[model samples]
Target: MTDRYAVFGQPIAHSQSPHIHATFGRQEGLALDYRAIEASPGEFLAALEAFAAEGGVGANITAPHKEAAFALCTTLTSRARRAGAVNTLLRKGDRWHGDTTDGIGLVRDLTDRHGLDLRGRRTLLIGAGGSARSVAPALLDAGILELVVVNRTPERADALIDAMGEPGRAITRYWEDIRELGDFELIINATSAGRDRAAEFKLPLSLVNSMTTAVDLNYGEAAIAFTAWARSAGCRNIVDGLGMLVEQAAESFLQWHAVRPQTEAVYTELRTQLAPLAGED
Candidate 1:
């Protein structure tokens, strides 16, 4: 039987998961079908159960569903436990196993794909949501000296730092104190701020210097806010989340199929495809 796989999340219509997985399967000469499954918050568990019932071997979870997926798992990888979120899932009999590839994906995209040296860099992470939680440990593992997490809700940032269990390396600061934090070698946006068309990122330019790399873990329209702010602040290396998306999909593909497919061909293809859509996005 051909392998059945899917990604589940609300607002999933625009997901590139199906395309990325299809390309990966084709590269490995596998007979597989991947799909984008839309599931609202109330419907997520039921929708996932239905997918698993239909021979689905694995799946990806995004956005608001990561924590939900984490809770639904029978077993989880240590990284997922640390993240308190799940972005990848596997089925075994009637049970689900969960793991998070997001952090490794972001690290690889930055270090391997983008030629970044993450070791010893001082980093600032915006927001304390699941995405921020997902990447924090990985940055520390990659040798970043310190991470300052700032969020609109100070408690969420405090909770994230507390959960990280690295009080010396990870610290929380109020968003209002952003200007006082000084410059960082890296600034990562893990917030949902840009998803709304009317929302704009108003970060202080003083937070970034010419050597700083600014990244938003969101792509397309959701990335506009941080990207606009980064450009205006003269950040030399500005990135959206597209590369991380493909990289993480590759990690999930390897976990399911035992083979890692090359990602640049698909990444370049998607970049070209999206270039024309940039204006509309």
Candidate 2:
């Protein structure tokens, strides 16, 4: 029987996981049936149970369900523990195992794909939600010498820092407190603020410079606010989360099928498809 899998989210119609996973399965010659499931907030566990009962080998969790999935997991990878969010779920001997691959995905895209170095670099992250939580531990592990997390809610920033525990080194700042931050080697926008069609968030121009590279964790329509700001601010390189999305799906695919699919081709193909959407935006 073909292994069953899916990506679950509340508003899942917008997810690209199905396409990415289909490419992965085809490339690896795996018998897999992956689809997108629109899960209700309260129905997450029920949906997981139903899918598992139907022989789902694994599934990917998104948005509102990441924390719920983390809470429901029988076991968690170290990264998942640090993230306090679970974006990937594996079915193991009648139990659901939770792990987050977002950080690894971002790091892989940054270092391996983009040829960017993280060691001893100053990194600024501009969100304190699940996306930031999922990527922080991995970014710290990637050898970033310093990281500052700035959020609209200072308490959220503090909570992210506290959840991270004693990082090798990290700091928290409020949006208003970061006026003097500048010349960051890497700046990541992990906020959900861009979801609005008229996103009004603005950054301190000092925080970015010619040397700065910006990454927005939300892709498509949601990334425009930050990426557009990055471009306007004279930042040379700006990346959205699409690559991270595929790379994370690739990791989940590996967990289910034990086959590592070549991501470059799929990435290129996805990028081409995404370009038209970007243009539409």
What TM-score against the true fold does each predicted structure earn?
0.95, 0.93
Model 1, runs deviating above 4 Å = 276-281
Q: Per-residue error at 6 for model 1, in Å?
A: 0.8
CA lDDT of every candidate: 0.89, 0.84
Superposed by TM-score, candidate 1 places the C-alpha of residue 178 at a distance from the truth, in angstroms, of 1.2
Tens-digit per-residue lDDT, 1-281, candidate 2: 56789999977898888888887877877656888988898888898898888878889998778888999898999889888989999988988899999999999988888887889879999888778889999999999879899988889888889888865478897677788766687899887789898996577788876667788888878888888888778776788898888888888888877776889988788778767323111
Per-residue CA lDDT of model 1 for 148-225, tens digit only, reads: 999999998898888789988999988889989999999999988899988988888889876898998988888888
Worst window of 10 by summed lDDT in candidate 2: 272-281
Locate the minimum summed-lDDT window of 10 residues in model 1.
272-281
- Cα-based RMSD of the predictions, in order? 2.5, 2.6
